[model samples]
Target: MILWFLGLMVVGLYLSFIMMRRSLKRSALIIVFGIGVVGSLLLITLNDNAHFGMVKRTTTNEQTIYTASPNVQMPMLLKQPAGTADKHAVYIYKTDPKKKAVHTKADLAVRNEISRTADTTASLTSQTTRWEYQNGFYGALFNHEGAGQFVSQRNQLAIPKDWFILTTTQAKRLSAKLKVLQHPTAQQKAALATKVKAKAAELVKAEPELATDQTTLMKQAQKAVQQQLIQQAVQDVQQHK
Candidate 1:
């Protein structure tokens, strides 16, 4: 995209220079060239500013499963479980900021209700901080002084300053879905693997140029399917909830 923009600018400048040379009046040529240069420079500046602004926004919007203050220690449970140690281990999706703005009223009401309920539960005395969702995974961000003690006893897990503990039912559902995601049925895996291999073989046979990268292409396809399955699992949990 950047290359295309630069190419256009170069072509525009060349045309402008040609027009300046052919002009009858020197003052008119100077005025036109100056305006064109100024306009182009302004556009380039705005384009750069916009690009950087987007990069800044994207950086700030990056999501993580866990984050901790300097004084806090991260919990072990938040770590990826042994088997599901790939990109699909923890699905993280960013919500559209515009959609978030649109639903602010209803979301606020729900949040207030949860806050009130948490206030009443003595066991949940810890201050109820805001909840955040990345993809379908939900967790509350709270502050607790005795977070370490909670983790040691296994009474309640602490995730940095906030903890994400699932109810028995939620845990069961999450586990079941994750199992399907991490380890698809033998038949499912076999079918997809065979299809990918066959497609790659055909492509390589037709265009021998792609033969060298056949293995890489096949792995990418398999990885894509795995990611799709993981997303589906997340969606299932969200819908059921």
Candidate 2:
């Protein structure tokens, strides 16, 4: 591509100069002038798009999960879709407790995926591919014209097993359900106690190590019960499923 661009400009100028000196016909001048114009147009197009003289680079980043529960007891992982449909996705999270929630980019250049992990801490690793001039020569030509620009990025989130993933729409359902569950009625309290006991037993059977520590066992059980409730809410609210 570079060779072609340079060749057109150099050859066109050489031919035009020779023709002018020899007093060539008007048609000869027009052909060489057209060559130069074509070459100039190509340069303008490449410089505008910043498509040439770029390299793809990958980078990774990690962020700790933020839990809004009072005791770090209920770990909630939230996600929001770009639109009513579930095609383009983005995550809502907070890397710091003090800062406001952060939403991942919803631009066409960005993509996201999630996976489960056994660790209690959640993290996000991103591979960003952007355009960067190959060297100073290309940079000098296209620096202010967007030499280095965002192309695309893929984010992979590895979340803890204990963390419950809920969409924003489902979260609203969860909030309403919690208000009802927190009622002072005796029946609701009894049912919650039963669910916690059942979830604890199920978890212990799956991983027997949790039974060794009574405090950790109960915490895990509490988290499990809440997660179960959220899962039910997700089912109730997901119309696009």
In terms of TM-score, the best-performing candidate is 2
Q: Name the regions of candidate 1 deviating beyond 4 angstroms.
A: 1-172, 181-184, 194-211
Residue by residue across 1-241, what tens digits does model 2's lDDT show? 4445556666666677665565556457656667776766777687666466667666667667575433256577777777766677778877787877787788878988889988878888888877776788876654445644788888888888867677777667766776665563888678888988888898889989889987888898887787677667656665532
Q: Give the backbone clash total of model 1.
A: 0
Q: Give the TM-score of each candidate.
A: 0.28, 0.67
lDDT of 1 by residue, 24-114 (tens): 5645655565665666566446444432112111111112222211111211122222223332122111123223111111111111111
Query: How many steric overlaps does candidate 2 have?
Result: 0
State each model's C-alpha RMSD to the native: 27.5, 6.5
Single out the weakest 10-residue window by summed lDDT for candidate 1: 148-157
